[model samples]
Target: MAGETDPLATEQPPLSAGDLPAELPGELIAPEVAALEVPPELVAQSLGEYVRAWGARIRGGDPGVLPVILGLAIIAVLFQIVSPGNVFLSAGNLVNLFQQSAVFMVLGMAEIFVLLLGEIDLSTGYVAGLAGVIGVQLVQPVTTNFPWWVAIMAALLACAVIGAAQGTLVARLRLPSFVVTLGGNLIFNGVMLWALLFGPFSGYPTLGDQTNPHVLYQLMWGTIDPLIGWIILTALVVVVGGSFWLRDSRRRRSGLVAPPVSLTALKIVLIAVVGAAVVAICNINRAHFGTIEGVPWVILIVIGLLGLWTVLLQRTRFGRYIYAIGGNPEASRRAGINLVRVRTLAFVLCSMTAGLAGLLYVANQGGASNNFPGGQYVLYAVAAAVIGGTSLFGGRGRVLHGVLGGLVIGGINNGLYLLGLDVKVQFVVTGFVLLAAVTIDALSRRGASVGSVAHI
Candidate 1:
């Protein structure tokens, strides 16, 4: 054992080596060597290394978000070419597209929590519908008349209770998640229908029937002034982005592993570019009757949630537990993770997020009705998550994947509408795309499995 050389030490790398010190003549001769031997935190210590590492990953069955982005781009271009008058890319239409995308994006994100743990949630649609129903009902003038914030909290709390109940069934009783959530779907749907059809006010509760629409209306319809939007973007780019760079630089100086300086700068640049582009698009006058300029409040809500979820998943122990449990439940249990608590929390968070999506749906639709299309929404939520590059098998995804995937779904829907295509076409396209994504995921999993076996 003392004289034997590591097989890793002798194997060929995918590319020329990184700068990691070598133990032999060509030990670090491959860009992928670091990925194999170096610690995770330092995998991207250089821009070239990041590129090489990601390239290797893609080849090795993990494409990350690249496929989703490419799909979104291709869909955008295709729709732009076919849409009458090229209206798919029009400022007004794009703004409306983003608004329409909010629900799907949020719902996809909601599903990600459970999906990461190799689980599915069928009740999300009705949970969201119930949230909207409860929220709108609570704010009715002749009924509860609760403040908007209180109504929101109440709605989220209710969804959380439902999530906990279903999660308990799966986690504690060892019931199948599909059966548990399917039951929840029916239960919540019935409750929503009853509340809508037989409740105190009416079957349809609106935000502004003699009462103020309040923040509920504002969340979807309100806008940040163009100047203010620019200022906020600038502040975020300079302050938050600068803080990250400083922290990473300090880490490097202290002999700690940190992302390469160039990689960090490139990320900041990307943020600035995307933020600026969003503001520019939103600032364009998109109104037919009057100038409706400035970024929509819904955009901020979506972006804010994206940032929050990204941090929660990437930087927190809870996030790690989710992935660990999802990737290998047996190993995770052996590693001392409280499997029940984490899974329960995942479901709770998923439901609460769906509640938020419900409120947004109400905002966009102007009312909560019995015909919220919860079933269709469930399908779309799963489709968007899958299309966005979140693996169906679990332990591989980001919240941004949901957003980008939502964009693809929204884009295709909007583009088809512009082209006067039937609604069925949209569903057909989405279904085919979802199938392709699932196929890719399955193949990637197999590829990864093969690679692991070869190494072993």
Candidate 2:
């Protein structure tokens, strides 16, 4: 037996507790040995799981700056395509566009206040018309012959009171805004008619109306020298540059993420280019039979209002409360935000601004007639806001959005006129554009809820 030892016995080791003999077979490895090291396949599986986890995180929705920029680009392209004869691109046309959009721009800012509170003011147009008639009556010699400043103040005060009254009914009595504003609209229209029929309201002041001439008219429509345009442009650049630098410094000091230096510089450059282009365009002579140059004072007035309203909404606590109320009224109340006061103030401001726009409109037109169709213009103001990205649901919009949106609408109007299109065609086209804008807004909101990049 010793001389004939088995070959298998010679290769096998002595079995120990918890150990397997080598002759047991390759497939008979102990479970403990198998568990000591992971297989390459297992490692590959774990890596796949990790990748999927990270992918999910990356797909989450995040607010970004791309949407706003893309919107502006698409607008520019559409206008270019629709009116390719350089008429839309001409310097004179651009200046005219700004002038034409001034009223809507002001109205848009007015709407912002109500929009922030998730409310609407259907009476704005009629209110403006009534205020204009009152303003003209006050300035008329047959009336009290009040100073222009006094008349303006009276008109603004009247509008504010009406607005406050409406707000009280809505906020205190819990009345529906649609019904309240609709009633107010009718009342204001009656007041306008009364003022025109009974009050001593003269037409707008003409160049040679009075012995001293109409200084106010001159101020509104007069042209500035080219030198003045350049000076104003330079001042604007300095102020805007200083503001950006200060903002960046504060952000850095607070350990907040500031925009990249390149991005900041790009913004400044873009602003400067736009300002320069505007100045150059306005400096051109557009007068065919007479001398007309530079921008209208109404243009400055509109821009000033825009800046003021933007600051109010973005920088003030009141503005914050308004937005809060719109977003979540109950939550805002729990946080001690006064819904009544803020809502009232917003309505008052909106009405006063509407008055301002109305005055500007009459001044630009040089007269106001009963057939001015204030109601139609009011609808246009609302449409402009919606088209410019102001959410109907509220708590989201910008003053600049209104300006750009107004310009887009004004451009369409001007372009259609230049192309010799009928007024009916213009109206139809505008209606379609408004519809498209609203559809896009709805789709964007839906996309945002679903974690899609198409939200814009």
Best model number under TM-score: 1
Model 2 misplaced stretches (Cα beyond 4 Å): 1-86, 198-208, 211-220, 452-456
Which residue pairs clash in candidate 1?
17-29, 17-30
Per-model TM against the reference: 0.90, 0.79
- Most lDDT-accurate candidate: 1
Candidate 1 Cα misplacement greater than 4 A, ranges: 1-41, 198-201, 209-212
Q: Write the per-residue lDDT of candidate 1 for residues 167-283, one digit (tens) a residue.
A: 998888989899999988899999998888745556887888444456787889999999999999999899869988998989988998898888788889999999999899999
- Residue 94 Cα positional deviation in candidate 1, in Å, after optimal superposition: 1.1
List, residue by residue over 342-423, the lDDT tens digit for candidate 2: 8888889989988987777666665566765678777777777777777677776777766766766776777777667887
At residue 220, give the lDDT of candidate 1: 94
Q: lDDT (0-100) at residue 274 of candidate 1?
A: 90
